[model samples]
Target: MSPGDEHDFRGMDQGGRGDDPYSTLGGTRQTRTRLPDGDAGHPHARRPVRNSRSLITITGVVVLLIAAIAFANRGGGNDDTASPTTKNPGAAGSAPTAPTGTKPVQGKNGTIASGFAHDEQGAQSAAANYAVALGSAEMFIAESRQSIIQATHDPAVAQKLQDDLDTAYSPAFYKNVGLNDDGSTPTGLTFVSRTVPVGTKVVKMEKDAATVEVWCTGLVGLAGQGSTKPVTETWFTISQELRWVGDDWKISSSSQAEGPTPVNGDNRASTADEMAAAVDVYGGFTYAR
Candidate 1:
């Protein structure tokens, strides 16, 4: 099968669409409106007070309300479009020549008001990168795991995630990847845990929250010659529901399922030495909108 066939492979990546957990969250309702000004203020205007202090305070309040109204109307419905420059600092720093590759035909993370008018794009970029961080190799180390959980997941769900993954990647898990019974690597071999995303979809998006499904295939193995644990590739899917909290996006919950994987390629398998070399040679990417 073509790589594209396996792109949506497995129950993990192509599990139809999961239910939208926040289908019930309320958002703003846009109704027809006549222009605001000149429509007439309250019939009785305040005594036309000329107190300079009062004038300054009233002006400040009006400016704030205008700002709030602008925020609520952002990320316009359905054909919702937001400025990409605003949400992600990583993207902001990226050279414009960098490619975005393909675009998904479906889904959008709902948009919410970012008080900062320039934050829409940055928020989306952060959400995507945060997803990568959540699915990265660093999550395996205890310290990195804690840091990832704290940085990428909602505080409300971090503890539960820490507990669940601890149980999931137990000694048995380590053993499968050629690690010791305690999840440590033997000398001279490098353990690998990588989640390479084929594509990502934001079924529903918002500036403040998003439901993104990441179609991923991963590599897990110990790369070294004459090693009992040979490197292997596994296909699985990882889904993340993220919420913008404080200033960055955090995962609220996530899950994985087995592949819609296709047959392996006919290319010759690389030697352990070559495999180790490749790992060292290749660098990772920072995915974004």
Candidate 2:
């Protein structure tokens, strides 16, 4: 994929503002009128050409703009104290905690995915992506599945969850996904199983770990016309227990529960091509409060 496409995925996750001038075009600094206020040793005042009131007003506006931008990028998800916490809350005696709230941008500075600002959303985004990686089509394939499970999960829990999931994706489930009974892809149809998190919130927090619940509704199926195994959507909530392993948060354990789900909307469904194209064209987000 092109660099542009990769950038689109990053934008899709955060503000979804690919075209935002302030964010995209580098306008973190605000513009304001400058006044020549000679507040030096000379106490004599001179006639000011610039409107003092207007200068004050413009400065005030610029200050407000800067403050607003800072708030939006604060990474606390919002200013709310109850907003989700970043996995790493800084040392207590250090500067007040700056939280994480978005994904590590999968952006290539040349070819590297740009790192994200550490905050609450960042942790949740990483967790959500980890969830997707864990509950993916890859999980069925032994080697790839093992790699994914090992990479994202705590060792003990990975094994336990693996055992349980192995049973869940049984022969019937494979058939339904247009895969061979062993979860291999069938000819002409692409097998898909992805957990797309809609949003995430922190249920509780601890010094070493956090209880995060990702409310996800996923699409699972084959994306070819005239296929018996049509793509279907499923809703579930995955509550993950994340530990502050190394510097980043890792999933120590997780449990899935049937949703406090909403009823299906009356919106018309799209064709296979439409759905497939949409998935590739549009991207997912790093969710936060």
TM-score of each: 0.55, 0.54
Candidate 1 residue lDDT tens string, 24-132: 0010111223333333554532222133332222122111211222122223222346434223233333334234443311222222112211133343454455545
Q: lDDT of each model, Cα atoms only?
A: 0.45, 0.48
- What tens-digit string does per-residue lDDT give for candidate 2 at 1-289? 1112212211123232333222211112222344465666545544323333332321221122212222222232322344354443333432322343433554322211223224454455656766566556666676676566556654545565455444455677455435688768776656555667776666555555666666666665566666554555555556566666655566665544434456444345667767666656665443332
Candidate 2 whole-model C-alpha lDDT, 0 to 1? 0.48
- Please give me the total number of clashing residue pairs in predicted model 1: 21
Please give the lDDT score at residue 222 for candidate 2.
62
In Å, residue 139's CA in model 2 sits off its true spot by 1.9
Cα lDDT for residue 146, candidate 2: 58
lDDT assessment of candidate 1: 0.45
lDDT of 1 at 30: 11
